[model samples]
Each structure stands twice: as structure tokens, then as C-alpha cells.
Target chain A: MPTTITVTVNGTTRTNEVDERLLLVQYLREVQNLTGTHIGCDTSNCGACTVHLNGKAVKSCTVFAVQADGGTVKTVEGLASNGVMHPMQAAFKEKHGLQCGFCTPGMIMTSIELLERNPNPSEAEIRRGIRGNLCRCTGYHNIVEAVKFAAAGTGGKK
Target chain B: MVTMTSAPFEYMRPKTVAEASRLLSKYGGGAKLLAGGHSLVPLMKLRLASPQALIDLSGVGELKGINSSASGLSIGAMTTYHELESSVEVQRAAPLLADAASQVADAQVRNFGTIGGAVSHSDPSADLPAVVLALDAVMKTATQRAGRDIPVERFFKDFLTTALRQNEVLTRIEVPKLPANTGTSYIKQSNKASHYAVVGVAAVITLGADGVCERARVAITGAGPYAVRAKRTERMLVGKKLAPNVIRNAAKRAGAEISGSFNEDVHASAGYREAMTQVFAERAITAAVANAR
Candidate 1:
């Protein structure tokens, strides 16, 4: 049976009727027209579908939309306020953290989560923190630098 | 990527443990419980598990949280790996569990995956099975009428299978606190891609007043059909000091102590797994002895 769920996405409340088996990633991209969260792997190997569920990073592809009802979800689109980008997003752009930009959104989302947990993380900690999210662009060198830069509090105007 | 999604199934979100048990009884084998959905959802996407119904236990309040006492600790099955990894009680009571939980998959998976789901799934390569087995933990389950406790030894029957009946739901895990003068460790060689153990060893050793081993428990995973206790190796350590030579000789017996044939998969061959099991077993026991009070 189709269920009507209310999920607060990017600080905005959304009520929609979704299929019982619809994945949260599919719902965010297709139903809500929020295409920022990319689906890289159907299996949970690639972390391109990373998003925050009640403040913790989780794979959206593996979570059903109905299961997230009454939950607060934070996607890549929710990071920026007004027109200013989040520090993690700004760091990615400043450090050239993208090649094809396919995994950039998920990478940025996951990095912000890492920074939140550990305000200042070591290089090895950054690598382990974002291990779940894979960037096919092979730009991990720059991505790691971006996270460190954001952690330093100089990556963006704070 | 293949457009793999779970098959259509009825979803039931039960608010209470009793309700969840009742729903499982109503659906029987057709129902699969969803804890974190980290393991099951992937199988469903690959069409390996096509349940006619899914009983969502995410909303069950009674199945979430941790309670500790002098005897042991009772952890709600729905508690996430992140919670377990960061828990001070878990770190102090059973560091083997916290250490193993931290190694499960990655940050995202640890944040969502629950210890209960991992135990119930009974994946041989999973880190928790061996850790829980070594800890002598007890598995608690609920049904429509009664609740029962099963030891870790009998709880795991085969690969990807448990003693949980169709009508039962695993509610919590009771892990006895490691005794004084005891130390434990869980070490594994994880596959880079999936982070599943190639060969994992969990050991707990309680040292006697004279520094000789009083009790020893060792369990291994990834090299067999299911995680098995290294009884031969454990017996060798029971009354002896953890000398380097004695530990090495005992570790060698772990490869032969397993009951079934070694698991040979794309990541590792049977012979390689056997060799690594011996190496990891030694490493785990040495570490445990070093930390023993």
C-alpha cells in the first residue's frame, strides 16, 4: 500500500505519497526533484547516496522513504543557506575537489558530517571517515585536502 | 549500476516489541525483520532475499538503548554500531565488541547498522559473531508468548542462519563484563572493498594471580562455514603463561580446529585463509595477554 509520509528535507517539511519500497535516494531525486544526491552504486559499496538522517550520515539508497517518515533529512542541497555555501562545500571548490563532479555532492555531504563529528581531524582520520564514499574521479588527494582545509576554519567565511 | 531495488513487499511498522513479535508470528517465514537494513536491503536488491512481508522494527522503542549492571550489560538490539563504538560502557565492559564494531564496514554503515541485525543475520565474515562468541554473550529473543535466552554457541547454526524461529524476534544481547585481570581483543584483515573480514580472531584471556592464564576463549570467523571456537588452542592456554612460543603453537592449531572446510572465495583461497587465521590468532592472543591486568 502507498503511504503518505512527512519528511523534513533541507529544513523544509514535505508530505508526499510514496510507494512502500521507494528508496529515500529515489524519493529525494525523482519525487522531490532534488537531483543533488546521486546514486553511484545500486549496492551500498559506493557512498554517492550519502545523506544525514537525524544528524548522522547514512546511505539513502538502502533506506526506504517510508522508514524516514517524521525524520529530519539533510541532503547536499540543504547545506547552503541564502546564497553562501557551507564551509565544506566552499573548501571543495577552493581545493579543486572535483574532476567530473559526479561524486562531488555526496563527497561534500559526507565531509561535512565528518567535520561535525571531529572539528579538527588528522589526515588519516579524514581518510577513514570518508572511506564509505568513493570518488571515481580519483581526486581523493584534493578531497582530503578540502576536508582538512574546512577543518582549519579558513576554507570559507565563518 | 544495475537498477536493483527490493521486490514489492508488505511493510509493517510495529511500535512495540510485543507487537513486532506478534506481527512476525502472523507472517511467519514470509516476514523478515528490518533493523538497520544494512545487510538485508542489499540482499533484497540483489534478489537473494525476497520476503513477502517486512516487519520494520525501527520504531520499536523497547528494542533500543543500553542498560548496564554489575553482572553484565543488556544492549537493545536496535542500537547502532556508532552507538556501540562510542559507548563508554561497551568500551570498558567489552572492548572486543567496541573494537570490532568500529571495524565494521565504514562510518556510514557503523552509523546505521545495528549489532542485533548483524548477530541475527549470522554472516560468517561479520566481525561481531566471533567477538560475541568469545565474550560468552547470551542472545535474548521474544515471541508471542514468552522470551528466551540462548547462548552464543547454539545461537548460530549455519551460514546466514540463526536459532531464531520464524515467530521470534531477537530483542537484546546480554554480554557479561570481562572479569578483573582479564583482557580481550578482536583483530581482523578486512577486505578493502566491502570491509568484511578475510580472517578475524577474537580472544579473551583472564590472568590468574600468579600471571598464569585462568581462562581462555578464542573464536574465529571468515575461514569456516560459521564462526567456531578454537577449543584446542584455548585448552592449550588455560593453565600456561602466554609465552611467545606457547602462543605460536596454539595459534597453529586454530587452522585445524575448525570443523568444516575453509571458505574459498574471490578474495582469498582456502589455504591462504588457513595461514592468515594462524597469524591473526597469534596477534589477537598476544594483544590480549599484553592488556591483561
Candidate 2:
């Protein structure tokens, strides 16, 4: 049976009819037309579907849309304000944090959440923070550097 | 891409432990208890398990939090790994728990995955089962009618199986407090991508005066049907001094202790897991010895 759920996304309230099995990633991409939350690995191994669920970063692919009902969600697209990208996003671009940007959105979103909880993480902590997210292109050197860059700028916040 | 999603099941989000237990008892093998769904959801997506109903435990408030008393630490079944990993009380009382919890799937998974669910699921490759076994923890379970506590040694029945009855729900895990001068370590060889341990070993040892081992409890994961205590290794280490040769001998004994077949999945082979188990046993015991000082 389809369930009626109301969720707040990107600062906008949305009420939609969704199947019980519909994943949050699908709801974001198909229903809301928010493609910024990419689904890299449906098995939850790839962190490409990372998004903020009530201010904590989680793989949207692992969460059912109904499970997210009444919760606040923040996708990669929601991080920007008025036209400015989040500091983590800007840091990724400035530090060459992408070769094939498929994993960049999830990486940036996850890093944003990590820094929120821990503003100044050591190099080892940064690596441990993103251990769930996989990036095959850049070998994570630039991603680590990007997080560091953002941490130095605004102490890893917006 | 393969379709990775749970099969059609009657999902009921019961608001109380009594309600969930009633559903579990009525559904028999057709119902599964869903705590964080970290273990069950993945298997459901893979079609390995197709229960007719899922009793969601997330809404049950009684199964959450870490409660401590003079007897020991009692962690609710719904207490997420994130809670255990970051809890100041856990870090202070059972620091090894925080270490083990920190290495589970990842931040996102840990945020939802619960300690009771992990131990109850009985994944041999998981990090917590061995740690709990080494700590001599007790698992508490309840049905609508009754409740009971099972020791960790008897809690894990076999691979992907636990002593929890079909109608019973795991409610809490009790880990006893170690005496002063006790040290513990958890060493795991994780699959870099999945974060599941390829081979994990946890050791808790107490040192007497002159650095002789007074008590040793060693448990190993990812090398057998279930995480098991290295009885031979533990027996050999007691009353022995913390020396390189003694630790190496005990570690070797731990490697030889496993006689059953191992998981032959793509992550590892039987031989490779055995070898890594020995390596981790050595590392964990050595680290525990150092920490004892």
C-alpha cells in the first residue's frame, strides 16, 4: 500500500504518496527532481547516496522514504545558500577533489556532516570519517586535502 | 545495476516491546525483528531472507540507552553503535567497546546499527560479537510472557544463528565490569570497502605483580561458524609472563583452535582467514599486554 508522507527537503515542505519500498534516494531524484543525491551503489557500499537525515549524514539508498517521513533532509543541492556553495563544496573544487565527479556530491555532503560534529579532525580522523564513502578516481588525497582546506577556512562550516 | 531492495513483507512498526513481541510470536519464522536493520535489511535486499512480516523495533523505546549499575553495564538492544562509540560513559567504563563499535560498518551504518542487534544477528565477521564474548557479556531476551539472560558463549549458536527463540526479542546486553589493572584490545583486518572484518580478534587480560598474566580471555571472529573464545590460548596464557615468546605461542594456539570450516565468500578464503586470525591474535594480545602496563 502506498503511504502518504510529509518531509521537509531543501527548506521546502513536500507531501507525497510513496510506496513503502521506495527508497529516499529515489524519492529525492524522481519525485522531487533532486538528482544531486546520486545512487552509486544500491547495496549501501558506495556512499554516493549520502545525505543529511535530521542533520546526520546517512546513505539515502539504505533508508525507505516512509522511514524519512517527518524528518528533515538535506541533499547536496540544499547545501548552497542564495547562490553560494557550501565551504566543503568549494574546497573540493579548489583542491581538485574530483576527477570524475560522480562521488563528489556524496563526499562533500559526508564531509560537511563530519566537520559539523568534529570541526578540526586530524588527517587520520578525516580518513576514518569517510571510510564508508568510496572514491576510485582520486585516491582520496585531494578529498582529504579538500576537507582540510574547508576546515581551515570556516572551521568546516557554511 | 542489480535491484537491491527488501522483498514484499508485512511491515508493522509496533510502538512497544509488548506489541512487537506479540507480532514476533504470532508470525513464527515468518517474522523478523528489525532494530536498525543494518544486518537484516542487507540480507533482505540480497533475497537471502524473505520473512512474511517485519516487526520494526525502532519505535520501541524500552530497548534503547546504556544503563550502568554496580553489577555491570547494561546496554539496551536498540542502542545504536553510534551511541556506544561516542558515549562518554562507554569510553570511561568499557573503552574496548567504543573501539569495537567505532570499526563497525561506518558512521552512517553505526548511526542506525544497534549493539544488541549486531550481537543477536551473530555475524561471525562482525567486530562486536568477539569483543562481547571476550568480555564475558550476557545477552538478555524477552517474549511477551517471559524474559531470560543467556551467556555470550551460549548465545551464539552457529553461523548467522543465535540462541534467541523464534518468538523472543533480544532486549539488552550486560557486560561485567573488569577489575582494576585489566587491559583489552580489539584488532581486526577489515575489508577496506565493506568495513566488515575479514578476521578480528579481541583479548582481555589482567596482569598481576611482576607482569604475570592473572586472567586471560581471548575471542576470535571471522575464522569460524561463530565468534569463539580461544580456550586453549586463554588457558596457556594464564600465570605466564607478558613476553614475546609467550604471546606468540598463545597466538599460534589460537590459530590452531579452529577446526571447523570458515566462510568461503568473495571477501576471503578459509586459509587466508586462518592466517589473518593468527596475525590478529598476536597483534591484539600484544597490544593488550602493552596497555596492561
Candidate 3:
């Protein structure tokens, strides 16, 4: 049965009727048209579907849309404001953190959570922080550098 | 990308533990109690689990948070790995639990995966089972019939199975505080792909004033069908000095003590798991002893 869910996404309150089994990532992509939350691997291993549920990063594919009812969601689309990139996004671009760019959104989302936890994570902490996220390109070196850049820019207090 | 979705099911969010248990009892085998959904959701997407109804426990406030009593720490069943890892009480009272929870999967999964869900799911390769087993934590559950407390040893029955009845909901886990002069450690050899432990060991030791072993508890996971107590190993160390040679000889008995066939997968062969079990056990016990002093 389809159920009605009221969720706050990207600072906007929206209500929609979604199927009971519709995944949070699918709802974000298809219903809200928030395609920035990529679904790289439906199995939840790829971490490309990472998003903030109630202010914490979680695999969107592993969560049913109904599960997010009355909760808040933040996607990569919500990161920037007023046509300006967030510091993390700017750092990614500045550091060339992405290669093919498929994993960038999830990487940035996961990295945002990582930075929130540890504002100035060492290279080793950065590697362990993103163990759930996978990037087949860029060898993760640039991503590590991008996180470092963001940490330095923000004084590690994100 | 694989567009896998769970099979359609009715979903209900109950507000209280009693309501959740009643719903579970009413639906019987058709209902699945949803916690953090890390384990169930993935299985559902894979079509391995297709419950007709899902009793969403997210709305049940009764099953959340961490509390400490003289008996020990009482962690609500829905408490997430993130909460466990960041909790000062957990770190102080059960550092091995914090160590194990911190190493589960990644930040995203840890943010949502609940300890109750993980323990109930009883994944052979999971980190908590071994740690809790070593800590002698007690599991509390509620059902239409009654509420019960299950020790860690009797709680886990087999691969991916627990002693939980069909209509029961695991309410919380009660872990006792370690005694003075105690030290604990949990270490795992993870399969890089999934981060599931290939061989994980958790050790807790209490030393007498003289520094001889007053008590020792050791548990191993991933190298067996379920986390099992390293009885022979514990027996060896309980009253001994825990010297380097004593630890090495006791660690070797961990692999030999398991009676069943080891889990063999692409990540590791039986022989490799057997070898790693001893290696991890030795490291975990040694680290625990060092921490004890």
C-alpha cells in the first residue's frame, strides 16, 4: 500500500504518497527530483547513495522512504546555497578530488559527516572514515587531499 | 545500477514497546520488526527476506538511549552504533564494546545500524557478538507471552539465528561493568570488501592484586557458526600468570575448540580462518592483558 510521508528535504517541507517499499534514494531521485543522491549500487556497499537523515549520514538505499517520515533529509543539493558551493564542494573542485565524478556526491556527503565528527582528521582517519564509500577512480588520494583542504579551510570545526 | 527494492509490505510505526510486541504477536510470522534496517533492508533488497508486514520500531521512543545503573549499562535496543561509539559511558564501562561498534562497517551504516538489530540478526561475522560474549552481557526481550533476560551464551543459537521467539522484540542489552584491575580488548581481521570480520576475538581479564589471573573471558566470532566462548583458552588463563608462553599456548586452543566446520567463503578458506582465529585470539588476549595492567 502507498503511504503518505511528510519529510523536510533541503530545507523544504514536502508531503508525498510513496509505496511502502520505495527506498529513500528512489524517492529523492524520482519524486523530489533530487538526482544528486546517486544510486551507484543498490546493495548499499558502494555508498553512492549517502545522505543525511536527521543530520547523520546513512545509506539512502538501505532506508525505506516511509522510514524517513517526519524526519529531515539533506542531500548534496542542499550543501550549497545562493549559487555558491559549500566549502567541501569547493575543496573537492579545488583539489580535483573526483575523477569520473560518479562517486563525488556520496564521497562529499560522507566526508561532510566525517568532518563533522573530526574537524581535522589525519590522512589515516580520513581513509577509515570513508571505508563505507568506494571510489574506483582517483585512487582516493585526491579525495584525501580534498578533505584535508576542507579541514584546513574550516579549521576542522565544520 | 541494480534497482533492487524490497517486496511490497504493509508498514506500521508503533509508538510503544507494548504496542510493538502486540503487533508482532498479531502478525506472527508475517511481521518483521524494523530497527536501523542495515541488516534487514539489505536482505529485503536482495529478496532474501519478504515479510508481509514490517513493524517499524523507529517511532518507539521506549527502545532508545543508553542508561547506567549499578547492575551495569542498559543500552536501548534501537541505540545506533554511532551512539555507542560516541557514548562516554559505553567507552568507560565497556570499552571493548565501543571498540567493536566503532569498527562496524562505515560511518553511514554505523549511523543507523542498531546494536539490538545486530545482535538479533546474529551475523556470524559481526563484531558485537564476540565482544558481548566476552563481557557476559545480558539481553532483555519482550513479547506477548512474557519478558525474559537471556545471557549472551544462551542467546545465540546458530548461524543468523537467536533464541528470540517469533513474537519477541529485543528491548535492550544490559552489560555489566568490569571489575577493578580488569582490562578488555576486541580485535578483528576484517574481509576488506564488506568489513565483516573473518576472525574476531574479544578478551576481558581481571587480575588479582598479586597480578595473577583472577578471571578471564575470551570469545571468538566469524571462525564459527556463531560466536563461541573460548572455554579452553579461558580455563587456561583464569588462574595462571598469563605469561607470553601461556597466552600463546592458550590462543592455539581457540581454533581446536570449535566442533563444527568453519565458515568458508571467497573472503577466506576454512584453513585460513582457522589460522587467523589463533592469530587474532593471541593479539586480542595479549592486548587485553596489557590493558589490564
TM-score of chain A of 1: 0.95
CA lDDT for candidate 2: 0.86
Error of 1 at B289 (Å): 0.6
How far is A53's C-alpha from truth in model 3 (Å)?
0.8
The candidate, 2 or 3, that scores higher on TM-score is 3
Give the proportion of true interface contacts each model preserves, from 0 to 1.
0.80, 0.33, 0.86
Runs in model 1 lying further than 4 Å from the true structure: A154-158, B1-4
Chain B of candidate 2 achieves a TM-score of 0.96
Kindly report which residue pairs in candidate 1 clash with one another.
none
Say which candidate scores most in lDDT.
3
Better of 1 and 2 by TM-score: 1
Count clashes in each candidate, considering only residues at least 3 apart in sequence or on different chains.
Answer: 0, 0, 1
lDDT of each: 0.90, 0.86, 0.91
Model 3 clash count equals 1
Tens digit of per-residue lDDT, candidate 3, span B1-293: 32547788999999988888899888878999999999999999888999999999989897999998787899999999999999999998888898899999899999999999999999999989998899999999997668999998999999999999888899999999889999999999988878889999999999998889999999999998988899998998888898999999999988766755788988898988999989999999999999999
* Order of the predicted models by TM-score, top scorer first: 3, 1, 2
Query: Candidate 3: where is the Cα deviation over 4 Å?
Result: B1-4
